[model samples]
Target: MQNLGKADKTTDEIFEDHLLNFNTQQVNATRLHKDINNYLRCIRAMQTANKNLMDTLSEIYEKEWVGQDMLYVQAQNNEMLWADLAHKLADQVVTPLNTYQAQFPEMRKKIDKRGRKLIDFDAERHTVQQMQNNPNRNEAKFIRAKEQMENAKRTYEVLNSELHDELPALYDSRILFLVTNMQTLFAAEEVFHSETSKVYSELEAVVDKLAKEVQKGTLPRRAYNRPLPIANHSAPVIQNSSSMNSPPKGATTDNLPPGVLYKVKAAYKYQAEDVDELNFEVGEIIQVVEYEDPEEQQEEGWLMGVKESTGQKGLFPANFSRPI
Candidate 1:
Protein backbone atom coordinates (compact mmCIF):
# COMPACT_ATOMS: atom_id res chain seq x y z
CA MET A 1 0.00 0.00 0.00
CA GLN A 2 2.89 2.38 0.82
CA ASN A 3 4.47 1.64 -2.60
CA LEU A 4 1.24 2.99 -4.15
CA GLY A 5 2.49 6.47 -3.26
CA LYS A 6 6.07 5.65 -4.50
CA ALA A 7 4.72 5.25 -8.07
CA ASP A 8 5.03 9.05 -8.30
CA LYS A 9 5.48 10.85 -4.93
CA THR A 10 6.08 8.92 -1.67
CA THR A 11 3.74 9.42 1.28
CA ASP A 12 4.92 12.05 3.86
CA GLU A 13 5.61 10.17 7.13
CA ILE A 14 5.58 13.47 9.10
CA PHE A 15 2.07 14.20 7.82
CA GLU A 16 0.93 10.81 9.13
CA ASP A 17 2.34 11.64 12.55
CA HIS A 18 0.53 14.99 12.62
CA LEU A 19 -2.69 13.37 11.47
CA LEU A 20 -2.39 10.84 14.30
CA ASN A 21 -2.01 13.65 16.81
CA PHE A 22 -4.96 15.51 15.31
CA ASN A 23 -7.15 12.42 15.59
CA THR A 24 -6.18 11.99 19.25
CA GLN A 25 -7.00 15.63 19.95
CA GLN A 26 -10.39 15.18 18.31
CA VAL A 27 -11.28 12.22 20.56
CA ASN A 28 -10.08 14.03 23.64
CA ALA A 29 -12.08 17.13 22.77
CA THR A 30 -15.21 15.02 22.41
CA ARG A 31 -14.60 13.41 25.79
CA LEU A 32 -13.94 16.77 27.40
CA HIS A 33 -17.23 18.07 26.07
CA LYS A 34 -19.08 15.17 27.71
CA ASP A 35 -17.23 15.62 31.02
CA ILE A 36 -17.89 19.35 31.14
CA ASN A 37 -21.59 18.85 30.52
CA ASN A 38 -21.75 16.28 33.36
CA TYR A 39 -19.95 18.69 35.66
CA LEU A 40 -22.49 21.41 34.90
CA ARG A 41 -25.32 18.99 35.65
CA CYS A 42 -23.80 18.09 39.03
CA ILE A 43 -23.43 21.74 39.91
CA ARG A 44 -27.08 22.32 39.06
CA ALA A 45 -28.14 19.32 41.16
CA MET A 46 -26.15 20.53 44.15
CA GLN A 47 -27.65 23.99 43.73
CA THR A 48 -31.13 22.46 43.86
CA ALA A 49 -30.29 20.47 46.97
CA ASN A 50 -28.96 23.62 48.62
CA LYS A 51 -32.11 25.53 47.71
CA ASN A 52 -34.27 22.83 49.28
CA LEU A 53 -32.13 22.89 52.42
CA MET A 54 -32.32 26.69 52.64
CA ASP A 55 -36.08 26.64 52.18
CA THR A 56 -36.41 24.10 54.97
CA LEU A 57 -34.25 26.32 57.17
CA SER A 58 -36.39 29.34 56.33
CA GLU A 59 -39.50 27.44 57.34
CA ILE A 60 -37.93 26.56 60.69
CA TYR A 61 -36.54 30.05 61.31
CA GLU A 62 -39.05 32.21 63.18
CA LYS A 63 -39.47 35.87 62.21
CA GLU A 64 -38.55 36.87 65.75
CA TRP A 65 -35.30 34.87 65.63
CA VAL A 66 -31.98 36.67 65.30
CA GLY A 67 -30.62 36.99 61.70
CA GLN A 68 -33.89 35.86 60.06
CA ASP A 69 -33.47 38.43 57.27
CA MET A 70 -29.76 37.69 57.04
CA LEU A 71 -30.51 33.99 56.52
CA TYR A 72 -32.71 34.80 53.51
CA VAL A 73 -30.03 37.06 52.04
CA GLN A 74 -27.31 34.44 52.49
CA ALA A 75 -29.44 31.76 50.84
CA GLN A 76 -29.99 34.08 47.85
CA ASN A 77 -26.26 34.74 47.60
CA ASN A 78 -25.48 31.04 47.59
CA GLU A 79 -27.98 30.45 44.78
CA MET A 80 -26.49 33.28 42.70
CA LEU A 81 -22.98 31.88 43.02
CA TRP A 82 -24.11 28.45 41.79
CA ALA A 83 -25.94 29.93 38.79
CA ASP A 84 -23.02 32.19 37.84
CA LEU A 85 -20.51 29.35 37.87
CA ALA A 86 -22.70 27.06 35.70
CA HIS A 87 -23.20 29.82 33.10
CA LYS A 88 -19.51 30.65 32.91
CA LEU A 89 -18.46 27.01 32.43
CA ALA A 90 -21.06 26.43 29.72
CA ASP A 91 -20.30 29.64 27.82
CA GLN A 92 -16.52 29.89 28.14
CA VAL A 93 -15.34 26.29 28.24
CA VAL A 94 -17.92 23.91 26.76
CA THR A 95 -18.97 26.23 23.92
CA PRO A 96 -15.44 26.56 22.52
CA LEU A 97 -14.84 22.80 22.57
CA ASN A 98 -18.10 22.31 20.69
CA THR A 99 -16.92 24.73 17.97
CA TYR A 100 -13.57 22.97 17.71
CA GLN A 101 -15.28 19.59 17.31
CA ALA A 102 -17.41 20.93 14.46
CA GLN A 103 -14.38 21.08 12.12
CA PHE A 104 -13.55 17.37 12.47
CA PRO A 105 -16.21 16.16 9.98
CA GLU A 106 -15.01 18.45 7.18
CA MET A 107 -11.37 17.67 7.88
CA ARG A 108 -12.08 13.92 7.77
CA LYS A 109 -13.76 14.22 4.38
CA LYS A 110 -10.79 16.15 3.02
CA ILE A 111 -8.35 13.54 4.37
CA ASP A 112 -10.29 10.67 2.68
CA LYS A 113 -10.32 12.61 -0.62
CA ARG A 114 -6.56 13.14 -0.35
CA GLY A 115 -6.03 9.35 -0.01
CA ARG A 116 -8.16 8.69 -3.15
CA LYS A 117 -6.25 11.29 -5.12
CA LEU A 118 -2.94 9.73 -4.06
CA ILE A 119 -4.06 6.32 -5.46
CA ASP A 120 -5.18 7.92 -8.75
CA PHE A 121 -1.81 9.68 -9.07
CA ASP A 122 0.01 6.39 -8.61
CA ALA A 123 -2.14 4.63 -11.29
CA GLU A 124 -1.49 7.40 -13.87
CA ARG A 125 2.26 7.34 -13.14
CA HIS A 126 2.30 3.56 -13.84
CA THR A 127 0.52 4.14 -17.18
CA VAL A 128 3.14 6.66 -18.29
CA GLN A 129 6.00 4.35 -17.18
CA GLN A 130 4.51 1.44 -19.18
CA MET A 131 4.11 3.62 -22.26
CA GLN A 132 7.74 4.83 -22.05
CA ASN A 133 9.00 1.24 -21.73
CA ASN A 134 7.17 0.06 -24.92
CA PRO A 135 9.40 0.20 -28.03
CA ASN A 136 6.45 0.83 -30.43
CA ARG A 137 4.58 3.27 -28.17
CA ASN A 138 2.25 5.76 -29.98
CA GLU A 139 3.34 9.40 -29.54
CA ALA A 140 -0.29 10.58 -28.94
CA LYS A 141 -0.94 7.86 -26.34
CA PHE A 142 2.35 8.55 -24.54
CA ILE A 143 1.63 12.30 -24.52
CA ARG A 144 -1.89 11.69 -23.09
CA ALA A 145 -0.49 9.41 -20.35
CA LYS A 146 2.08 12.07 -19.33
CA GLU A 147 -0.61 14.75 -19.22
CA GLN A 148 -2.91 12.51 -17.11
CA MET A 149 -0.02 11.72 -14.67
CA GLU A 150 0.77 15.45 -14.25
CA ASN A 151 -2.89 16.33 -13.60
CA ALA A 152 -3.29 13.54 -11.00
CA LYS A 153 -0.06 14.63 -9.26
CA ARG A 154 -1.30 18.25 -9.10
CA THR A 155 -4.67 17.22 -7.59
CA TYR A 156 -3.06 14.94 -4.99
CA GLU A 157 -0.39 17.59 -4.08
CA VAL A 158 -3.06 20.25 -3.45
CA LEU A 159 -4.83 18.15 -0.81
CA ASN A 160 -1.57 16.71 0.66
CA SER A 161 -0.01 20.16 0.91
CA GLU A 162 -3.08 21.65 2.59
CA LEU A 163 -3.15 18.85 5.20
CA HIS A 164 0.62 19.11 5.75
CA ASP A 165 0.32 22.83 6.50
CA GLU A 166 -2.83 22.76 8.61
CA LEU A 167 -2.68 19.48 10.58
CA PRO A 168 0.49 20.33 12.56
CA ALA A 169 -0.81 23.80 13.44
CA LEU A 170 -4.21 22.36 14.43
CA TYR A 171 -2.62 19.76 16.71
CA ASP A 172 -0.31 22.32 18.30
CA SER A 173 -3.24 24.63 19.10
CA ARG A 174 -4.62 22.02 21.51
CA ILE A 175 -2.42 23.16 24.40
CA LEU A 176 -3.38 26.82 24.08
CA PHE A 177 -7.07 25.95 23.92
CA LEU A 178 -6.89 23.71 26.96
CA VAL A 179 -4.93 26.21 29.04
CA THR A 180 -7.19 29.16 28.27
CA ASN A 181 -10.51 27.36 28.80
CA MET A 182 -9.38 25.51 31.95
CA GLN A 183 -8.18 28.77 33.46
CA THR A 184 -11.54 30.39 32.87
CA LEU A 185 -13.35 27.46 34.54
CA PHE A 186 -10.98 27.48 37.53
CA ALA A 187 -11.32 31.25 37.99
CA ALA A 188 -15.09 30.94 38.03
CA GLU A 189 -14.85 28.17 40.65
CA GLU A 190 -12.56 30.27 42.87
CA VAL A 191 -14.88 33.25 42.86
CA PHE A 192 -17.96 31.12 43.48
CA HIS A 193 -16.38 29.30 46.44
CA SER A 194 -14.91 32.46 47.98
CA GLU A 195 -18.24 34.32 48.02
CA THR A 196 -20.21 31.24 49.06
CA SER A 197 -17.82 30.62 51.96
CA LYS A 198 -18.37 34.16 53.24
CA VAL A 199 -22.13 33.67 53.17
CA TYR A 200 -21.80 30.32 55.00
CA SER A 201 -19.70 31.93 57.74
CA GLU A 202 -22.32 34.65 58.22
CA LEU A 203 -25.06 32.01 58.54
CA GLU A 204 -23.02 30.23 61.21
CA ALA A 205 -22.64 33.47 63.16
CA VAL A 206 -26.42 33.95 63.08
CA VAL A 207 -27.02 30.57 64.74
CA ASP A 208 -24.36 31.30 67.35
CA LYS A 209 -26.02 34.60 68.21
CA LEU A 210 -29.44 32.98 68.54
CA ALA A 211 -28.04 30.37 70.93
CA LYS A 212 -26.41 33.06 73.05
CA GLU A 213 -29.62 35.11 73.23
CA VAL A 214 -31.64 32.04 74.24
CA GLN A 215 -29.11 31.23 76.99
CA LYS A 216 -29.55 34.76 78.35
CA GLY A 217 -32.90 36.20 79.48
CA THR A 218 -33.27 38.20 76.23
CA LEU A 219 -35.40 35.52 74.55
CA PRO A 220 -38.65 34.45 76.18
CA ARG A 221 -38.01 30.73 76.40
CA ARG A 222 -40.38 30.12 79.30
CA ALA A 223 -42.78 32.51 81.08
CA TYR A 224 -44.58 31.59 84.31
CA ASN A 225 -46.46 33.18 87.24
CA ARG A 226 -43.46 32.43 89.47
CA PRO A 227 -39.75 32.19 88.63
CA LEU A 228 -37.33 29.47 89.65
CA PRO A 229 -34.42 30.27 92.03
CA ILE A 230 -31.15 31.10 90.31
CA ALA A 231 -28.11 29.11 91.37
CA ASN A 232 -25.60 31.31 89.58
CA HIS A 233 -26.29 34.71 87.97
CA SER A 234 -23.03 34.81 85.97
CA ALA A 235 -23.06 31.59 83.99
CA PRO A 236 -25.03 29.43 81.46
CA VAL A 237 -25.68 26.86 84.22
CA ILE A 238 -29.06 25.08 84.27
CA GLN A 239 -29.52 23.83 87.86
CA ASN A 240 -27.75 23.73 91.26
CA SER A 241 -28.67 22.77 94.83
CA SER A 242 -29.08 25.29 97.68
CA SER A 243 -29.76 22.75 100.49
CA MET A 244 -31.11 19.16 100.82
CA ASN A 245 -31.70 16.80 97.92
CA SER A 246 -35.45 17.64 97.72
CA PRO A 247 -37.40 19.78 95.23
CA PRO A 248 -39.68 22.72 96.18
CA LYS A 249 -43.32 21.74 96.77
CA GLY A 250 -46.11 22.63 94.30
CA ALA A 251 -43.73 23.02 91.33
CA THR A 252 -45.73 23.88 88.16
CA THR A 253 -46.18 20.97 85.75
CA ASP A 254 -47.68 23.25 83.06
CA ASN A 255 -44.23 24.66 82.17
CA LEU A 256 -42.84 21.13 81.78
CA PRO A 257 -42.63 19.34 78.43
CA PRO A 258 -45.49 17.23 77.04
CA GLY A 259 -46.00 13.51 77.90
CA VAL A 260 -44.71 13.92 81.48
CA LEU A 261 -45.38 10.69 83.45
CA TYR A 262 -44.30 12.24 86.80
CA LYS A 263 -41.75 14.63 88.37
CA VAL A 264 -38.67 13.26 90.12
CA LYS A 265 -36.26 14.98 92.53
CA ALA A 266 -32.54 14.50 91.88
CA ALA A 267 -31.11 12.32 94.70
CA TYR A 268 -27.56 13.19 93.61
CA LYS A 269 -25.96 15.94 91.48
CA TYR A 270 -25.47 14.73 87.91
CA GLN A 271 -23.12 16.63 85.59
CA ALA A 272 -23.62 15.92 81.89
CA GLU A 273 -20.55 15.09 79.86
CA ASP A 274 -22.30 14.68 76.53
CA VAL A 275 -24.51 17.14 74.68
CA ASP A 276 -27.41 14.61 74.62
CA GLU A 277 -27.49 14.35 78.47
CA LEU A 278 -29.07 16.88 80.82
CA ASN A 279 -27.26 18.19 83.97
CA PHE A 280 -29.05 18.81 87.22
CA GLU A 281 -28.47 19.69 90.91
CA VAL A 282 -29.26 17.43 93.94
CA GLY A 283 -32.57 19.19 94.81
CA GLU A 284 -33.73 20.01 91.23
CA ILE A 285 -37.04 18.62 89.92
CA ILE A 286 -36.85 16.66 86.64
CA GLN A 287 -39.98 16.04 84.54
CA VAL A 288 -39.71 12.60 82.97
CA VAL A 289 -40.84 12.50 79.34
CA GLU A 290 -41.26 9.81 76.65
CA TYR A 291 -38.28 8.53 74.74
CA GLU A 292 -37.89 9.88 71.18
CA ASP A 293 -37.20 6.35 69.94
CA PRO A 294 -38.34 2.89 71.10
CA GLU A 295 -34.77 1.65 71.34
CA GLU A 296 -33.95 4.27 73.94
CA GLN A 297 -36.49 2.74 76.32
CA GLN A 298 -34.54 -0.53 76.28
CA GLU A 299 -31.44 1.11 77.77
CA GLU A 300 -30.80 0.15 81.43
CA GLY A 301 -32.60 2.68 83.63
CA TRP A 302 -32.17 5.52 81.13
CA LEU A 303 -34.87 8.18 80.94
CA MET A 304 -35.48 11.30 78.81
CA GLY A 305 -36.60 14.35 80.82
CA VAL A 306 -36.57 18.12 81.28
CA LYS A 307 -34.78 19.84 84.21
CA GLU A 308 -37.43 22.20 85.70
CA SER A 309 -34.88 24.83 86.79
CA THR A 310 -33.57 25.80 83.33
CA GLY A 311 -35.85 23.79 80.96
CA GLN A 312 -33.01 21.67 79.54
CA LYS A 313 -34.20 18.37 77.97
CA GLY A 314 -32.03 15.32 77.36
CA LEU A 315 -31.36 11.74 78.40
CA PHE A 316 -30.58 11.22 82.11
CA PRO A 317 -29.80 8.12 84.19
CA ALA A 318 -32.98 7.14 86.07
CA ASN A 319 -30.88 5.75 88.93
CA PHE A 320 -29.81 9.32 89.86
CA SER A 321 -33.38 10.49 90.59
CA ARG A 322 -36.47 9.16 92.46
CA PRO A 323 -40.20 9.83 91.83
CA ILE A 324 -41.62 12.60 94.07
Candidate 2:
Protein backbone atom coordinates (compact mmCIF):
# COMPACT_ATOMS: atom_id res chain seq x y z
CA MET A 1 0.00 0.00 0.00
CA GLN A 2 2.83 2.39 0.84
CA ASN A 3 4.55 1.65 -2.52
CA LEU A 4 1.27 2.20 -4.43
CA GLY A 5 0.74 5.58 -2.72
CA LYS A 6 4.30 6.63 -3.44
CA ALA A 7 3.83 5.71 -7.16
CA ASP A 8 0.60 7.74 -7.44
CA LYS A 9 2.21 10.82 -5.86
CA THR A 10 5.13 10.57 -8.29
CA THR A 11 2.77 10.43 -11.30
CA ASP A 12 0.81 13.50 -10.16
CA GLU A 13 4.02 15.45 -9.55
CA ILE A 14 5.25 14.60 -13.08
CA PHE A 15 1.98 15.92 -14.63
CA GLU A 16 2.24 19.12 -12.57
CA ASP A 17 5.76 19.70 -13.87
CA HIS A 18 4.59 19.11 -17.48
CA LEU A 19 1.83 21.72 -17.04
CA LEU A 20 4.34 24.26 -15.73
CA ASN A 21 6.67 23.67 -18.70
CA PHE A 22 3.77 24.09 -21.14
CA ASN A 23 2.80 27.44 -19.56
CA THR A 24 6.40 28.69 -19.82
CA GLN A 25 6.60 27.73 -23.49
CA GLN A 26 3.32 29.50 -24.22
CA VAL A 27 4.58 32.74 -22.60
CA ASN A 28 7.83 32.68 -24.56
CA ALA A 29 6.03 32.11 -27.86
CA THR A 30 3.64 34.98 -27.22
CA ARG A 31 6.48 37.39 -26.38
CA LEU A 32 8.48 36.38 -29.47
CA HIS A 33 5.44 36.84 -31.70
CA LYS A 34 4.76 40.33 -30.32
CA ASP A 35 8.35 41.40 -30.89
CA ILE A 36 8.35 40.18 -34.48
CA ASN A 37 5.09 41.99 -35.22
CA ASN A 38 6.49 45.24 -33.84
CA TYR A 39 9.59 44.89 -35.99
CA LEU A 40 7.48 44.41 -39.13
CA ARG A 41 5.41 47.49 -38.34
CA CYS A 42 8.52 49.60 -37.89
CA ILE A 43 9.92 48.44 -41.23
CA ARG A 44 6.69 49.31 -42.97
CA ALA A 45 6.62 52.79 -41.50
CA MET A 46 10.19 53.49 -42.57
CA GLN A 47 9.45 52.39 -46.13
CA THR A 48 6.44 54.68 -46.32
CA ALA A 49 8.43 57.69 -45.13
CA ASN A 50 11.22 56.99 -47.60
CA LYS A 51 8.74 56.76 -50.46
CA ASN A 52 7.21 60.10 -49.54
CA LEU A 53 10.60 61.78 -49.45
CA MET A 54 11.43 60.50 -52.94
CA ASP A 55 8.10 61.73 -54.28
CA THR A 56 8.67 65.18 -52.81
CA LEU A 57 12.05 65.44 -54.46
CA SER A 58 10.55 64.60 -57.84
CA GLU A 59 7.75 67.11 -57.40
CA ILE A 60 10.05 70.03 -56.57
CA TYR A 61 12.74 69.41 -59.15
CA GLU A 62 12.99 72.38 -61.54
CA LYS A 63 12.02 71.79 -65.17
CA GLU A 64 14.60 74.08 -66.78
CA TRP A 65 17.63 72.38 -65.31
CA VAL A 66 19.82 70.07 -67.39
CA GLY A 67 18.90 66.34 -67.18
CA GLN A 68 15.34 67.21 -66.14
CA ASP A 69 13.98 64.24 -68.09
CA MET A 70 16.65 61.90 -66.76
CA LEU A 71 16.06 63.08 -63.22
CA TYR A 72 12.39 62.24 -63.45
CA VAL A 73 13.14 58.81 -64.84
CA GLN A 74 15.67 58.06 -62.13
CA ALA A 75 13.27 59.17 -59.43
CA GLN A 76 10.62 56.87 -60.81
CA ASN A 77 13.07 54.00 -60.94
CA ASN A 78 14.02 54.56 -57.31
CA GLU A 79 10.38 54.64 -56.33
CA MET A 80 9.77 51.37 -58.11
CA LEU A 81 12.79 49.82 -56.44
CA TRP A 82 11.53 50.83 -53.04
CA ALA A 83 8.09 49.42 -53.77
CA ASP A 84 9.62 46.19 -54.97
CA LEU A 85 11.63 45.92 -51.79
CA ALA A 86 8.55 46.36 -49.65
CA HIS A 87 6.61 43.83 -51.62
CA LYS A 88 9.42 41.32 -51.46
CA LEU A 89 9.80 41.76 -47.73
CA ALA A 90 6.12 41.24 -47.15
CA ASP A 91 6.00 38.19 -49.37
CA GLN A 92 9.14 36.52 -48.12
CA VAL A 93 9.25 37.46 -44.45
CA VAL A 94 6.09 39.02 -43.10
CA THR A 95 3.71 36.59 -44.73
CA PRO A 96 5.47 33.58 -43.30
CA LEU A 97 5.68 35.18 -39.90
CA ASN A 98 1.96 35.88 -39.93
CA THR A 99 1.18 32.37 -40.99
CA TYR A 100 3.30 31.02 -38.16
CA GLN A 101 1.61 33.30 -35.68
CA ALA A 102 -1.82 32.25 -36.87
CA GLN A 103 -1.22 28.79 -35.40
CA PHE A 104 -0.91 30.22 -31.89
CA PRO A 105 -4.63 30.83 -31.27
CA GLU A 106 -5.55 27.25 -32.11
CA MET A 107 -2.73 25.93 -29.97
CA ARG A 108 -3.86 28.10 -27.06
CA LYS A 109 -7.42 26.78 -27.34
CA LYS A 110 -6.12 23.22 -27.29
CA ILE A 111 -3.97 24.00 -24.26
CA ASP A 112 -6.99 25.39 -22.43
CA LYS A 113 -9.07 22.34 -23.30
CA ARG A 114 -6.18 20.13 -22.15
CA GLY A 115 -6.15 21.99 -18.79
CA ARG A 116 -9.83 21.06 -18.21
CA LYS A 117 -9.12 17.46 -19.15
CA LEU A 118 -6.18 17.38 -16.71
CA ILE A 119 -8.47 18.54 -13.88
CA ASP A 120 -10.97 15.78 -14.65
CA PHE A 121 -8.13 13.23 -14.78
CA ASP A 122 -6.77 14.39 -11.42
CA ALA A 123 -10.26 14.15 -9.82
CA GLU A 124 -10.78 10.61 -11.12
CA ARG A 125 -7.25 9.62 -9.96
CA HIS A 126 -8.00 10.94 -6.49
CA THR A 127 -11.31 9.04 -6.35
CA VAL A 128 -9.58 5.76 -7.35
CA GLN A 129 -6.80 6.36 -4.78
CA GLN A 130 -9.31 7.00 -2.00
CA MET A 131 -11.34 3.89 -2.95
CA GLN A 132 -8.16 1.81 -2.63
CA ASN A 133 -8.02 2.78 1.10
CA ASN A 134 -11.75 1.98 1.67
CA PRO A 135 -12.50 -1.32 3.39
CA ASN A 136 -15.78 -1.82 1.54
CA ARG A 137 -15.22 0.08 -1.69
CA ASN A 138 -17.51 -0.62 -4.70
CA GLU A 139 -15.28 -2.46 -7.14
CA ALA A 140 -17.29 -1.33 -10.26
CA LYS A 141 -17.08 2.43 -9.22
CA PHE A 142 -13.31 2.21 -8.67
CA ILE A 143 -12.82 0.48 -12.05
CA ARG A 144 -14.85 3.20 -13.81
CA ALA A 145 -12.85 6.01 -12.16
CA LYS A 146 -9.53 4.35 -13.16
CA GLU A 147 -10.77 3.94 -16.77
CA GLN A 148 -11.86 7.63 -16.93
CA MET A 149 -8.47 8.77 -15.62
CA GLU A 150 -6.64 6.68 -18.25
CA ASN A 151 -8.71 8.19 -21.12
CA ALA A 152 -8.11 11.77 -19.87
CA LYS A 153 -4.39 11.08 -19.49
CA ARG A 154 -4.16 9.80 -23.08
CA THR A 155 -5.92 12.89 -24.48
CA TYR A 156 -3.70 15.30 -22.54
CA GLU A 157 -0.53 13.43 -23.44
CA VAL A 158 -1.37 13.58 -27.18
CA LEU A 159 -1.76 17.35 -27.15
CA ASN A 160 1.23 17.88 -24.87
CA SER A 161 3.46 15.63 -26.98
CA GLU A 162 2.57 17.40 -30.22
CA LEU A 163 3.15 20.84 -28.69
CA HIS A 164 6.36 19.81 -26.98
CA ASP A 165 7.79 18.63 -30.29
CA GLU A 166 6.39 21.41 -32.53
CA LEU A 167 6.99 24.56 -30.46
CA PRO A 168 10.73 24.03 -30.04
CA ALA A 169 11.10 23.27 -33.74
CA LEU A 170 9.13 26.42 -34.62
CA TYR A 171 11.22 28.48 -32.23
CA ASP A 172 14.44 27.17 -33.76
CA SER A 173 13.24 28.08 -37.28
CA ARG A 174 13.09 31.79 -36.34
CA ILE A 175 16.85 32.02 -36.60
CA LEU A 176 16.94 30.88 -40.23
CA PHE A 177 13.94 33.00 -41.12
CA LEU A 178 15.57 36.10 -39.68
CA VAL A 179 18.84 35.44 -41.48
CA THR A 180 17.09 34.99 -44.82
CA ASN A 181 15.04 38.16 -44.41
CA MET A 182 18.05 40.28 -43.47
CA GLN A 183 20.18 38.90 -46.29
CA THR A 184 17.48 39.56 -48.87
CA LEU A 185 16.82 43.09 -47.63
CA PHE A 186 20.46 44.08 -47.53
CA ALA A 187 21.22 42.58 -50.93
CA ALA A 188 18.35 44.41 -52.59
CA GLU A 189 19.35 47.70 -50.93
CA GLU A 190 22.94 47.28 -52.05
CA VAL A 191 21.95 46.83 -55.67
CA PHE A 192 19.48 49.68 -55.48
CA HIS A 193 22.04 52.15 -54.10
CA SER A 194 24.67 51.12 -56.63
CA GLU A 195 22.40 51.80 -59.58
CA THR A 196 20.90 54.96 -58.11
CA SER A 197 24.32 56.40 -57.33
CA LYS A 198 25.31 56.16 -60.99
CA VAL A 199 22.20 58.04 -62.01
CA TYR A 200 22.90 60.72 -59.38
CA SER A 201 26.49 61.07 -60.60
CA GLU A 202 25.34 61.57 -64.19
CA LEU A 203 22.75 64.12 -63.11
CA GLU A 204 25.39 65.98 -61.08
CA ALA A 205 27.68 66.13 -64.10
CA VAL A 206 24.92 67.70 -66.21
CA VAL A 207 24.21 70.26 -63.46
CA ASP A 208 27.90 71.10 -63.18
CA LYS A 209 28.12 71.67 -66.93
CA LEU A 210 25.14 74.02 -66.83
CA ALA A 211 26.72 75.95 -63.95
CA LYS A 212 29.94 76.33 -65.90
CA GLU A 213 28.03 77.65 -68.92
CA VAL A 214 26.27 80.19 -66.67
CA GLN A 215 29.63 81.36 -65.23
CA LYS A 216 31.15 81.69 -68.70
CA GLY A 217 28.16 83.80 -69.99
CA THR A 218 27.50 81.35 -72.81
CA LEU A 219 23.83 80.51 -72.42
CA PRO A 220 21.70 80.23 -75.56
CA ARG A 221 20.23 83.40 -77.06
CA ARG A 222 16.71 82.62 -75.83
CA ALA A 223 17.95 82.47 -72.23
CA TYR A 224 19.19 86.09 -72.46
CA ASN A 225 16.23 87.72 -74.18
CA ARG A 226 15.30 89.84 -71.14
CA PRO A 227 16.19 93.54 -71.27
CA LEU A 228 19.51 94.44 -69.65
CA PRO A 229 19.47 96.38 -66.36
CA ILE A 230 20.62 100.02 -66.60
CA ALA A 231 24.01 100.52 -64.98
CA ASN A 232 24.07 102.32 -61.61
CA HIS A 233 26.47 105.08 -60.66
CA SER A 234 28.35 102.58 -58.52
CA ALA A 235 29.43 100.64 -61.60
CA PRO A 236 32.46 101.85 -63.58
CA VAL A 237 32.18 102.25 -67.38
CA ILE A 238 35.03 101.67 -69.84
CA GLN A 239 35.65 104.40 -72.41
CA ASN A 240 37.61 104.22 -75.65
CA SER A 241 38.04 107.34 -77.85
CA SER A 242 38.35 105.16 -80.95
CA SER A 243 34.77 103.87 -80.36
CA MET A 244 33.18 107.40 -80.56
CA ASN A 245 30.82 108.24 -83.47
CA SER A 246 32.68 111.47 -84.44
CA PRO A 247 35.55 110.80 -86.76
CA PRO A 248 39.08 111.78 -85.64
CA LYS A 249 40.88 114.72 -87.39
CA GLY A 250 42.27 113.80 -90.78
CA ALA A 251 41.31 115.88 -93.87
CA THR A 252 40.59 112.84 -96.09
CA THR A 253 36.95 112.64 -97.38
CA ASP A 254 36.93 108.98 -96.23
CA ASN A 255 37.41 110.24 -92.61
CA LEU A 256 33.93 111.93 -92.69
CA PRO A 257 30.78 110.46 -91.12
CA PRO A 258 28.86 107.97 -93.39
CA GLY A 259 32.02 107.65 -95.50
CA VAL A 260 34.17 104.52 -95.21
CA LEU A 261 37.74 103.62 -96.19
CA TYR A 262 36.55 100.10 -96.99
CA LYS A 263 33.63 97.69 -96.44
CA VAL A 264 33.63 94.21 -94.87
CA LYS A 265 31.05 91.49 -94.09
CA ALA A 266 30.76 89.68 -90.73
CA ALA A 267 31.70 85.99 -91.03
CA TYR A 268 30.04 84.90 -87.74
CA LYS A 269 27.82 86.12 -84.90
CA TYR A 270 29.37 88.67 -82.56
CA GLN A 271 28.18 89.63 -79.07
CA ALA A 272 28.78 93.27 -78.17
CA GLU A 273 29.51 94.20 -74.54
CA ASP A 274 29.48 98.00 -74.34
CA VAL A 275 27.28 100.75 -75.91
CA ASP A 276 30.20 101.56 -78.23
CA GLU A 277 30.21 98.06 -79.84
CA LEU A 278 27.72 96.72 -82.38
CA ASN A 279 26.02 93.32 -82.03
CA PHE A 280 26.12 91.94 -85.59
CA GLU A 281 24.51 88.92 -87.21
CA VAL A 282 26.37 86.82 -89.75
CA GLY A 283 26.64 88.24 -93.32
CA GLU A 284 26.05 91.90 -92.24
CA ILE A 285 28.18 94.67 -93.76
CA ILE A 286 30.61 96.75 -91.67
CA GLN A 287 32.14 100.13 -92.67
CA VAL A 288 35.88 100.36 -91.88
CA VAL A 289 37.24 103.63 -90.44
CA GLU A 290 40.90 104.58 -90.78
CA TYR A 291 42.77 104.85 -87.45
CA GLU A 292 43.54 108.49 -86.50
CA ASP A 293 46.79 107.40 -84.84
CA PRO A 294 49.01 106.08 -87.59
CA GLU A 295 50.78 104.12 -84.83
CA GLU A 296 47.47 102.24 -84.16
CA GLN A 297 47.44 101.00 -87.77
CA GLN A 298 50.45 98.85 -86.86
CA GLU A 299 48.12 96.50 -84.94
CA GLU A 300 47.31 94.04 -87.74
CA GLY A 301 44.76 91.87 -85.96
CA TRP A 302 41.94 94.44 -85.27
CA LEU A 303 39.94 97.07 -87.17
CA MET A 304 37.85 100.12 -86.18
CA GLY A 305 34.43 99.80 -87.86
CA VAL A 306 30.83 100.99 -87.90
CA LYS A 307 28.08 98.41 -88.39
CA GLU A 308 26.02 99.29 -91.51
CA SER A 309 22.77 98.16 -89.80
CA THR A 310 23.13 100.35 -86.66
CA GLY A 311 26.01 102.75 -87.44
CA GLN A 312 27.55 101.80 -84.04
CA LYS A 313 31.35 102.09 -83.97
CA GLY A 314 33.70 99.64 -82.24
CA LEU A 315 37.01 97.81 -82.60
CA PHE A 316 36.27 94.35 -84.04
CA PRO A 317 38.53 91.42 -84.78
CA ALA A 318 39.83 91.90 -88.32
CA ASN A 319 39.71 88.15 -88.91
CA PHE A 320 35.98 88.08 -87.88
CA SER A 321 35.03 90.64 -90.61
CA ARG A 322 36.08 89.52 -94.07
CA PRO A 323 37.00 92.25 -96.67
CA ILE A 324 34.09 92.89 -99.07
Query: How many residue pairs clash (N, CA or C atoms closer than 3 angstroms) in each of the candidate models, in the order given?
Result: 0, 0
Q: lDDT winner among the candidates?
A: 1
Name the top TM-score candidate.
Answer: 1
Candidate 2 C-alpha lDDT tens digits along 122-155: 6677778889899899989888888988987788
What lDDT score belongs to each candidate, Candidate 1 first? 0.77, 0.64
Show model 2 residue runs off by greater than 4 Å. Answer: 1-63, 219-324
lDDT of residue 247 for candidate 2: 29
